[model samples]
Target: MKHPVELLALKQTHEQCLAHADALGEALADMRVRALDAASYEHLDKDDRRLLDQFAYRYTRLQDDMGAKLMPAVLRALGEDIAAMPALDRFARLEQLGWLASADDWATLRQIRNAFAHDYPDSAQERFERLQAAASAASQLMDCLGLISRQMLQRFGDLH
Candidate 1:
C-alpha cells in the first residue's frame, strides 16, 4: 500500500477491466433487444439468424473474458491474495466478502460457459437453448460487475 507505483499499476489494470465490462454490458443490451427466446428460435428469419449468431459469439467472449481475466484482476486490485488460493476458494472468499452473490452462482456461470464452448452446430435446439441461457447469464454477470465496480469505487475512490 505504501508503494505509489504498485498502486498505480493496480488502478490502471482495474480501470481496463472496468472498461471492458462496460463495453460488454452495452453490447449485451443491444443484443438483448434483437435476441429471440428459445420458444421462437424456429421462427427466426435470415436477418434474425445473422443477428443471433453475432450475439452468440459476443456473449461467449464476454463470459470467458470476464471470468478468466477481468474478475481475477479486479480481485487483485481489491487486495485479494488470489495467488495463494485455489480458484474455487478464491471465488468462495469473494462471495463471503460480498463481491460475488454466491459461489454456486459462479459455478453455474462456468457450467453455462462450458456448454457454449462445446456447442454442436448441427443441433439447433441445443444451440438455441444455450444462447438463451447465455443471454440471461450475461445480464447477471453485468450485475455482478456493477457490484464489484461500486465496491471498488468505494474502497479506492476514482480508479482512473
Candidate 2:
C-alpha cells in the first residue's frame, strides 16, 4: 500500500480495540456462564455488576470508534473517494469492494450500539433485555472488525 504509515496507525487502533474487547469478554465470561436474566442481574455482586456495566460501555465505544473514526480513515487511506459520502454510503462501498460482508449488518450494528444509550430505569426487564442484545451485537461487531482487518492486511500487505 502507498500509505503504509496510515495502515500502521489503523493497525494500532485495531489492536487496541481487540485488547479492550478481550478484556471485557474475560470479565463477562463468569457472569455469562450464570445465564443472567433481570432477576439474575439483580443478584450479582457489586464487582460483577460493574463488569457488566463496563462491558456495555466499552462495547458501544468500540463499535462507535470503529465505524465513525477507524473505518472512514481506512477507506480514505485505501484511496476511496468517500469524503462527501454519508456513513452508510461509505459502508456500502466497503461492502462492494469486498472488505465488508454486509453493509446492512454494519449499519444495524450501529443501530444496536445506539440503542444502548437509552435508560430504562422504570423497566428493569427492558434494560436487562437491552443489555443482553447489546452483548450479542458487540460480539458480532468484533467478528466484523476482525474480518475487515484481515481483508485490509490481505489487500494492503501486512505491515507487521
How does each model score on lDDT? 0.69, 0.76
Per-candidate clashes come to 0, 0
Instruction: Please name the candidate that would achieve the greatest lDDT relative to the true structure.
Output: 2
Model 1 residue pairs with clashes? none
Worst 10 residues of 1 by lDDT: 1-10
Tens-place lDDT per residue, model 1, 119-157, is 665666877877777767777776777777777677667
List model 2 lDDT by residue over 13-57, tens digit each: 777777777866765675577567898665677876777877877
TM-scores of all predicted structures: 0.76, 0.88
148 in model 1: Cα distance from truth in Å? 0.6
Which residues of candidate 2, in runs, are more than 4 Å off? none
